[model samples]
Target: MFSYRVEGTWRRLKRHGWSRQQPTRRAIERDEDVVDVWKKETWSRVRAPRWSVGPGSSSRTRPGSR
Candidate 1:
């Protein structure tokens, strides 16, 4: 059977756009807290657009239609 393990810091870094590379177990385990904080900051910068309707709107048009 295959086994997998995750570190708190590594998981956080991943959410912040960090790439995965093979590292010694000790390094990742030691840095979990710092990584988590960075990930949260990075994620918050990502935003989604809001939509508004105007008088010219047509019923046949879809959300993404131009």
Candidate 2:
């Protein structure tokens, strides 16, 4: 019979190429209300592409294809 502690299990997982992701921390002065307003009012317009080349036209999808 064998058992693993939390630390031992974590070590084994790390050795097997497993990784742990930590949640990012926000600044103390961060304001969610302002962020929400900006996202709704500004982000949409800012994120839009100025010009589009059209659909299914990425160069990486089919190189040298006419």
Candidate 3:
């Protein structure tokens, strides 16, 4: 019976020029302008929230009061 080891298989794959990659696929109905707006404005707000209410302020906290 033939058996394969993980390490050996990984080394063989690498030697064959195989690489791990994730290809991003955008939705067919995706809108570039809306995405740009969200990235510029909504992304910041979504990434950081006010009133952390914890030990020390969060570094992700947005500047200025909402």
Candidate 4:
């Protein structure tokens, strides 16, 4: 494999249509208190990892599957 400089690598990625995602901006009036509460309560319930394989599924699924 060939080594690349930081700028060169980023340029190559961009050339291949892999633009970096822009940072998400929050509203100036966003409430930190509400955000914190949601993180503690709502996020905890749904933040569990989803990558676990079930009994019949492997890392590779059926090759011809859509």
Look at candidate 1 and tell me the lDDT of residue 24: 57
Which residue window of length 10 is worst by lDDT in model 3? 57-66
Q: In model 2, where do residues sit more than 4 Å from their true spots?
A: 1-13, 16-18, 49-66
Candidate 3 local Cα displacement, residue 66, angstroms = 32
TM-score attained by model 4: 0.37
Indicate whether candidate 1 or candidate 4 has the larger lDDT: 4
RMSD of each candidate relative to the true structure = 14.2, 9.4, 9.9, 10.3
The estimated TM-scores of all candidates read 0.26, 0.39, 0.37, 0.37
Over 4 Å off, model 3: 1-9, 15-17, 24-27, 49-66
Q: Which lDDT value does model 1 have at 10?
A: 75
Higher-ranked by TM-score: 1 or 3: 3
Tens-place lDDT per residue, model 3, 1-66, is 878899888888999999777767988899999999999998988875687664553355754434
Better of 3 and 4 by lDDT: 4
After superposition, candidate 1 runs with Cα above 4 Å error: 1-30, 46-66
lDDT (tens digit, per residue) of candidate 1 on 1-66:
844467766787888999778855575456877878877886567655557665543557665445
Question: What range of 10 consecutive residues in model 2 has the weakest lDDT sum?
Answer: 52-61
The per-model lDDT (C-alpha) reads 0.68, 0.86, 0.80, 0.84
